[model samples]
Target: MLIRVLFAVLVVVSLVLGYVGLAEYLATSAQYAHRPLDLLYYDLQLFVINSAPVSNGGPYPWPLEVSRFLTPAVTAYAVVEAARLLFASEIARLRARRRARHIIVCGDSLAARTLASHLDAEHRVVRVESARSPAPLIAAGLPRAARLYACADETAANIATVLAASQVERKVHAPLEIHAHVSDPELGDALRDRGWREGLEVDFFSLDGVAAKQVIAAEQPDGERLVVIGLSAFGRALLLELARRRTEPVEVTVVDPDGEAVVAELAARHPFFAVACHVSVVPVYQPEPGVHLVFVCHDDEERALRDGLNAAATVDATRGTVIVRMAELAGVGEMMVQHGQEDRLRFVGVLDMASVYLSERITDSLARAVHRRYVRAQRALGQDVRSNPSLVDWDDLPDTLRDANRASAGDIERKLELVGCRLVPSLEAAAFTFEPEEVERLAVAEHERWVAERRADGWRYGSRRDNERKLHPDLRPWSDLGEAERQKDRNVVLALPEILADAGYRIVRR
Candidate 1:
């Protein structure tokens, strides 16, 4: 708007100057340029061609040249400036359309929006709706996107976005990274399975899980009595994480109106709650001295803040800390850091949870990638990387292999998720054993997977184990394999649950 106004003023001033200059030249030289049509024609000719239609017999030649040049220059400048201002939005869109290797964030949910905010500083971000169809993706500049985040509120919508993005052929040479927001364990497993089977780079994460881990890590409530308000999804996840982290038995008193029902249901789903930690359910919060940490995680933002503040007020400021889950941290900043108050009050917003979740996602991806590289390098040297007992530290690997390993780790994790298996040493205790016949099928499935991976790497069917530096070079039919080889295969299949657990997944069933 300002550009248009400035140019308009310039155009009017130029025309007036041109008219006045031509009139003065005619008056001083007795050229009779005072006739209105003649004067207008002469001004127009000067502005267009920097030359008057008739010779300006003015006394000063320089003044005539200045008038001619100034009129045309100002008029051209006004036209160009007006066009640029009028089409500014369209020009920006065009530039974005041509850009590649940018991040595309799907959905308008709080988590998605928050995640985008963190990434916006380092990457170009485009937001799109979570539609089943691919039109929204294309409209959101998916073809140019290097990373796509599927963070819709609904699990189904997130899944759809990931699937749609996976099928998109990015303009860049590298595969597009698809990060999906997953709150449910089951949904995460399913998406991971799809990624493994198809070799797509899809990641699943939950802000609730991120929040739980972060709170537990910060509080470090080891063997300390704690009070947790609300038994919502976020609350249960936090309780479960706390129980997992605590080495010593700690009493956790859960408070809410329907605490009993929530705790009972959650305990059934998660066995650690019953075995590792002692927990009690109550209808209302009863603040006590010596409380190590108070987590007010009610779904209602205002109530949670109020409850946390009230609990902090009752507790001795030096011993206990109150943490409140709020939608917006700015609204109640004063309560978080009360002036002249000893009780340390902390506020955790959804955006904070989202930020933690994204950071974890990157960390997990990189770790898995590095591990994958380590295993692959071992395999190339004829070592059974999968069966190797030692766990390799990702940080120990060299920089050259880090990127390749990260990519391969994504593939390996996807495959691991697809088989509904993982390598947990405690998996046998966690999962029910299958029938002998089913166990045989599991071994055969692993054998088939091994064969497929070998074939993909250009290994042919062979049985010459002497010359070839192959760990399992005897590529004969599975039926012909010895009992020892078969047993090892079966052991690998049985370890699936533990492996899944290690990858932040809970294997509920064998």
Candidate 2:
């Protein structure tokens, strides 16, 4: 707005100066008398083409030359500035579209801002302020977006954003990945369930889950003695994940004012925690020697920071790593970076963790789905696949194969959900039922997914004799498939409903 006003002022000043300066030059020096209207007309012409000869047909007066030079310069400046102002937004939209993969983040919340900051360093990010509607996403170029993050302050706003983005994705068939932020893990799980039912690409992320993963992943093998000084959502999540990931039996002392009741509730919620680790709850912090990790995760940022600092002071600097969770982490992070670097203190922020939680929703889920299919396919081949499909290192998969598998998994999931056999969590939790025909339709979808995965692994169509017994050469549609081949696809689809249940999911009607 300021730029437009400045350009307008420049243009007006130029016009006035051109007319007055040239008119005075004509009257005094050239002795060429003319009407004020005539002088104004001449000045307008001069402004359009400053180098054009003066109509006086005499040596150009000094003032006329000055007017000539100043007029066109300002005129050109105004014209260019006007054009830029008119098309600036369009040009920016075009630039964003040209980026092969870009993310659209909607909302002005801390999570949205943090995500944009993290992503902007590498990927093109278009941020929109509208949290209540999806219109901002469409206006921000949703058709070209590879991912959309809806991280609003309110859960309802985030849900609304997902609905809006889903509508855009359905209309364009653009395969846009949408991520919605939810603080509660159960709510996030329910949203994922709803996503499968809606046949839309949406996932929910929790910052507490992200922080739990981060802290657990940082632990060394020998480090088992840990002190967790809160029973907040994040603290409980950390303890559960720690127990789940621990190979050997471990002990975790939980210091919470809520006492044994909170610990008992958490253990019951996650049965694995009870079987894998010993959790002792105490009323207050007790500094124990050889404590490997100390986590001060409180809802209040100041209290968490103070508790973390106190815990850090008690622990041996060379032996323990202190992890602090703060709603706002800027001051603590900088303070630790400056003074507490030697103490091995780690800081986690509720809002900034959204970047980690939301960034991998699409890719990570795709990878997991591919791994599940791989295990199912291998079992069908009569190979002795392990009880735990994720036992094998997914990171060791070839880049080409992983990419292909993820793409194929995404396509398969979409198609399966479009039909009635959408995935859900357990039989009792199923929101809808899959009909016999819908289950049969999934066989055809699975067959295509198989073919695509095989092709991705470098298999190609060819005659058996020419190909010398190459795999997946006789790829055919479900109708053309013989009973044996059809059975293979059907076997995978038939196993899905129960397999999903065992894997903490089920297949429900779309």
Candidate 3:
């Protein structure tokens, strides 16, 4: 931008200098009689190296001589810049194709653009205008890309790009991590559960889900009473995320016109809804007393803001917060602050939150480390691919399992808090350890956390372990677990320091 500005200034200055010099030359010299407009026109011609003002000149003015060289140089620079602008994308695409381990973002959608913008400068990002065909993906360097994000506006387009990328992955005999943006929660769930091509690891995510995760992380909304207004996709995602994070059942009231249908849909999709939350549905928007957090998730930004404001007015300022879902924060957020409701009224932008969380989740070092540790542990136990399906590499692991690992990684901070320790950034190698009693306590906590997670995922205790039926023998109480099962939890607890260290963090007793 600064270069363009300088170039523009140079062009204007050159043109002005040329006009003044030509005017002065014509005024003093007896060569030609021309008007000011004609002088200006002739001065403009100098830029293109066109007709010179002087036919038979004895001497030229200093300004005229300067303009004579400056105009043409500026013209040449303009031409070169134009050419560069025209071919920059193509050049970048070609270079990206030759580069190995680069990230390819295949889409021009908001999510894709946002993700591309948020990506770290360390990783080379190649963006395709659209993902309607495999040609663009290949052109964007899909074959050599370490990761591909198919974030087209249409879910179908993202799926098509994923399939194309998978075929390329198979042909090249190289691994690729593909993340597809599926807006519909049910479709995202179904696609994830159905699984994808073997050699290529595929994951599906929704804007709402990402936004919900961001909101929970930022707000830490763990109140006893929660109210969700407007049963939009974001609302559903928020409920699910809340359920996943909460260790105990929380009272939740969902206010929407189609409350019954929404409740039924949630129950059908997630059996763990009943286990993690005590929920009630109400058609009318009522300000429930003692509500800790209220999420206004209307699809319409204006409606969401209006409801959020109303909730903010009634809810206790000290105890409650109203979070409104917004497409962007510019107009609505300022209005809230102006109205002095900034403290209690918060807004979450879908694209902003989604882009941030999506990038972090996809390239999460801690989550990758967690998966690697799990794989190592499984291998140490002599478990092969046939014996354990999750005994594969991080890229080859299914999305569900990957999410579980990510969830476990996400809980490390909370686990650290339980042991009176906190994670702090560290550049050097971390060699921290927990006390023996602390490790045992954390192990118990980890086991209980795992059991809750399993139950919330619709798993049930059974005599035999069955993945197909969502049954596991170790789903019983921590006391009922054999020493082997208990040891696994203890191992994870002990490995906390190493895991945190790998992710550039070290545990420090608080």
Model 1 C-alpha lDDT per residue in residues 346-388, reported as the tens digit of each score: 7777556666567455555434534644465567667763665
Which regions of candidate 2 fall more than 4 Å away from where they truly are?
A: 1-60, 90-101, 169-174, 195-199, 220-223, 247-249, 259-261, 326-335, 338-342, 349-510
lDDT of 1: 0.65
- Model 3: runs farther than 4 Å from truth? 1-44, 50-58, 61-63, 120-122, 169-174, 213-223, 242-250, 316-318, 334-339, 366-373, 376-510
Listed in order, each prediction's TM-score against the native is 0.60, 0.61, 0.67
TM-score for candidate 2, please give it: 0.61
lDDT per residue, candidate 3, 1-510, as tens digits? 998899999988898888888887888656666798888888888889884574445377888878988999999998998999999988977886676666788887877887898885656788776766677777777776667888888888898887777666422333466788887765776787666665566778888877887787677666558889988889988888887777888888889878778787787778887678788888877776687888999888878878887888888767888888887553667576778756788888888777776677555767987886777778998998999888876645766898898889888889889878898755345578789899888999898888889999999999998889999998998889899999888999998877765554678998
Instruction: Give the 10-residue window scoring lowest on summed lDDT in candidate 2.
Output: 424-433
Query: In model 1, how many backbone clashes occur?
Result: 10
| Steric collisions counted per model | 10, 2, 0
Model 3 / residue 425 / CA error / Å: 22
